[model samples]
Target: MANTTSAKKATRKIARKTAINKARRTRVRGCLRKVEEAIAAADQAAASEALRIAQSELMRAVSKGVFHKNTASRKVSRLSKRIKALSA
Candidate 1:
């Protein structure tokens, strides 16, 4: 339990931030799932489009501190490679 007023305020702030972070993470996951679904269906066009949207969502998460830059880059790289393979 937070004994001090400032500590209570800090706890509230953390909870709000946590909620925002969770929402951002969820959004990123949903975008990635869309890409994965397109890939699994072997639809090159849909996969390409999904990857585009996922990439943007991923970078946004990175900028918001929900994901590390390298983690986002790695995800984008793997998804792009998979999309390219679908076309090939």
Candidate 2:
């Protein structure tokens, strides 16, 4: 229900941005899941590697505004802590 031409254009732009953001969110979640799976399996090496990749992807998502900076940091921190605990 975009009445004006500009409104229609804005809607289109929003749709494109929504798609991109959704993809980024999915990617970040996938990365986090990989880390969690590794942790659950108690594989220290795999968990460590997955955490590294997840941290990178999470930070990237933060940069893209898919997640807040502190949110990403907290997730990374908690996951790293879990990974450390795996070694103990």
Candidate 3:
């Protein structure tokens, strides 16, 4: 349905970006889930480590434009707070 060559190229670029963004989102969710699981299990060390990983993933996603920087920061802050509370 793309009527122009440029439109076809744009479609291709969008598809590739979509796939990449999806992968980044999936990875961030997994990392967040791992941190949540560790917190639920009351493993402070594991939770801390997982949070660290999740925070890094979030930051990376933000830098890559998959997520807003403030959004990532808020997520990291909330997760870290929960993790800290679990340790206390």
Per-model TM values vs. the true structure: 0.97, 0.97, 0.96
* Per-residue accuracy of model 3 over 2-25 as CA lDDT, tens digit each: 989999999999999999999999
Candidate 3 ranges beyond 4 A from true positions: none
Tens digits of per-residue lDDT for model 1, 16-67: 9999999999999999999999999999999899889989999999999999
Order by lDDT, highest first: 1, 2, 3
Model 1: residues >4 Å from true position, as ranges? none
Candidate 2 per-residue lDDT over residues 1-88, each given as its tens digit:
9999999999999999999999999998999999999999999999999889999998888888999999999999999999999888
Number of backbone-clashing residue pairs for each candidate, in the order shown = 0, 0, 0
Residue 37's lDDT within candidate 1 is 97
Displacement of the residue 47 alpha carbon in candidate 2, Å: 0.6
